[model samples]
Target chain A: MSPSVAYGTDIDERTKAAEQSATDVLTAPDIPWNLVIWNDPVNLMSYVSFVFQSYFGYSESKAHKLMMEVHKKGRSIVAHGSKEQVEQHAVAMHGYGLWATVEKAASGNETPGKGGRQRG
Target chain B: MAKAFKYGLKGISGYLEPAERDLLRGLLDDVISMLESDVRENEDPLAALIGLDMDVKQPGDRALLRLLPNVMKDDDGGSLEFRQLTERSVRESKIGALRAAALGLDKNELVLTPDDATRWSMALNDVRLVLAERLDIRDEADAEHIHSMQDWSQAEDVESYLALVYNFTTWLQESLVQAMMAARQAKS
Candidate 1:
């Protein structure tokens, strides 16, 4: 069978190109990463908010919002940037006694499939 | 009461009476000692406490794990490697911070410089971590258990005393953080 016949006739050129583009983007090494802070029982809520403010230079309101997000939602993407940037933020957060990790941010509507492991 | 925060342009100029200063100094001193011992243990777990017949167990040591958490939670090998690469520097930084805070305690009224504020933040956090681990404080209930048993007389169990310290440090750190944020806002 020909290459087109082997696949389905329903697959159009546009759909195939879109899929290829998505794969290329996702596979690229420069995907944006998120520095996530996880809520834990040990650290105080006020301390967590303070960390967000002092370290990230976030405004008080913004810091409080992120802190509450982490508190109520279990985790929050406190920062988003290149891998190194996010990793640095994660390390800084760790130094401040916050439970933090770095993970690749899922782009667009695409679900972050497997291997979405958190890194410190 | 918690440590009273006195914010200034330089940083928090918090006043600690002689007794308060002594209390903080004592706590930070303890933390410094704990961290120093941990460093020694890390170098050679068995040799570090050979005379004391103590074993330095990694990950299993609740206080050690809390103070220097595993960066990689899912992979044991990766976590071990991460600890190997970063734990020493982390421990040193924590020790440095604690020592700096200890220096501030010499004065009856401890004034934290901007840098000192940051150091105090980190140092106090470590103190809380160690206390949390020792208290087996997994949640609010665990903390409350200690709080409910508080006695001003030095007669109650040590857990109550430790709980008082933990709560006091939490407030101190919170106030320091607030002062820092306010200072940052003022600068901008």
Candidate 2:
């Protein structure tokens, strides 16, 4: 039998699969999650930028750029980190009255149908 | 008077004259009453034992739903349960903030503890959300249209009036956030 196969029954295939899963878990930190803020009709652009600057410590210019992106693009990736970290961010944004969500960064490009009616 | 906010080691501070304060007080009170009236004691003795209440129906109002978002987008059952468990606390916190703001109105000066500052920020955002819904404010042009009309006397247009309130609340909320940020920056 090949070195890849263990002596026991179907355990060899199961072992390889488990090993692959373990490797994926070990590399998981590199696969970042994104905290996305969706535009709302109610939230002011200036207020959004201020929240970005206040909570995230982003500079004025950077915050403004992101705010504009959220306005024009309907959503913006505001932060990137592990799942727990991004979830915390999304909750905090919700607390600040902005619509927010977290998703795998690799899958961030998928845009769900917009929720609220569009504002200007 | 133009609304403004200031920050220091003493905490965040702002001024509102009697008329302005009254207007704000009324607005806060309105939202608080709306949120509070939604809750009622759980009638079932069995349910009461576990701290569950069926009286406060889940908020069917769009504005209320917006204020309380689901934790999980993928799981409908989980999200509904989460909202059921959390709706009361969220409404209470919102009411608490409005009351905190009301406390400062009589004095014409509002001073918030760091914690209260955060609450005020959140509460102000809620007020704006409610008003925005009423105004049908959908984007920059809508806001600008109202801004352009601010100088005119729109005595008949209820939306025009609500728009003014919305704009003022936005300024107030922005100032609070900026003040908090400045204080944080100073600490570092």
Candidate 3:
């Protein structure tokens, strides 16, 4: 399913630079944590994508990419933030019945999108 | 047979036969009961009221553990601390959704507002998850095996019955999510 055009926006260089600096600062002392969604046999692919789109406000392509990563790679770091932020997301993901866990970003080799802070 | 949920002028709507409604109601209630915590004797009333459950342990049952997974993958102490702070509220919200969906099943014709549809989807998903666990659906291969059990005549055993149920919920949730996506598109 295609997401609305309004939902998808290009990340410009200015935004990218700001996010890079923010990530650098956040990583220095408080290592950002990742909210990883693990793939399971039960959760519907559409439902997982919908949660990504609705809960995290990821665009359809972005959500589908993350969902496919989870399905193929066995897990995908869907979001990353402070420990508490990722923990809150973990709870919300559990509420949606998706298998989820939080980990310090350094603990895993894969880094999710740079400064992927969720919209409130 | 239940109609696949669809988004229309009246929002997301679906229809189910009485037996189907009863079946769904049973599933929703089962998940609700699984999530509901038992009252402890001489417990701290304030902590309970504030949704703290320091006594909460990692669920022993596989299905229950699936429902309320530990936050940290390797840090049990940290996970337990986070669980103490958040698990109670999570359980309450899950039970609330399960109960809401169960209450909606009282009628055969289901019309759902966005909120109702969200709760229904969550409830159906939770049902499917627990059923998957019981059916021992560990991987895609196991899921495919379960998905192949479509004929009612083949549901001669408990495992097959659960597989059928899991497939039913999976279909239902897929349709509901599609409708939700459509509704979201319409709004945007």
Off by over 4 Å in 1: A1-29, A81-83, A104-120, B1-3, B9-11, B40-58, B144-155
**DockQ of candidate 1, scored on C-alphas against the true complex (2 decimals):** 0.22
In the range B39-121, model 3's lDDT, one tens digit per residue, is: 46787999989989889898999999999999888999998998899998888888999999988988888999999999999
Residue B185 lDDT (model 1): 59
Instruction: Rank candidates by DockQ, best first.
Output: 3, 1, 2
Overlapping backbone residue pairs in candidate 1 total 0
Model 1, A1-120: lDDT tens digits are 011123355659668877978986786557566677787777878778777665665656877888888888787777766666666666677688788766667777223222222332
Task: Tell me the tens digit of each residue's lDDT in model 2 across B31-117.
Answer: 888787755554677764554554544467767667766655565565556455545556666778788877767776777777787
Overall local distance difference test of candidate 3: 0.86
Write down the lDDT of every candidate, Cα atoms only.
Answer: 0.69, 0.70, 0.86
* RMSD (Å) of each candidate, 1 decimal: 11.3, 11.0, 3.7
lDDT tens readout by residue for model 2, A38-111: 88767867678877766776666777888998999898877776666666665567667788766666654643
Q: Measured against the native two-chain assembly using Cα atoms, what DockQ does each of the candidate structures obtain, in the order listed?
A: 0.22, 0.19, 0.66
What TM-score does chain A of each model score against the native chain A? 0.64, 0.65, 0.73
TM-score for candidate 2 (chain B): 0.84
Model 1 CAPRI quality: incorrect
State TM-scores per candidate: 0.74, 0.71, 0.90
The weakest ten consecutive residues by lDDT in model 3 chain B span B34-43
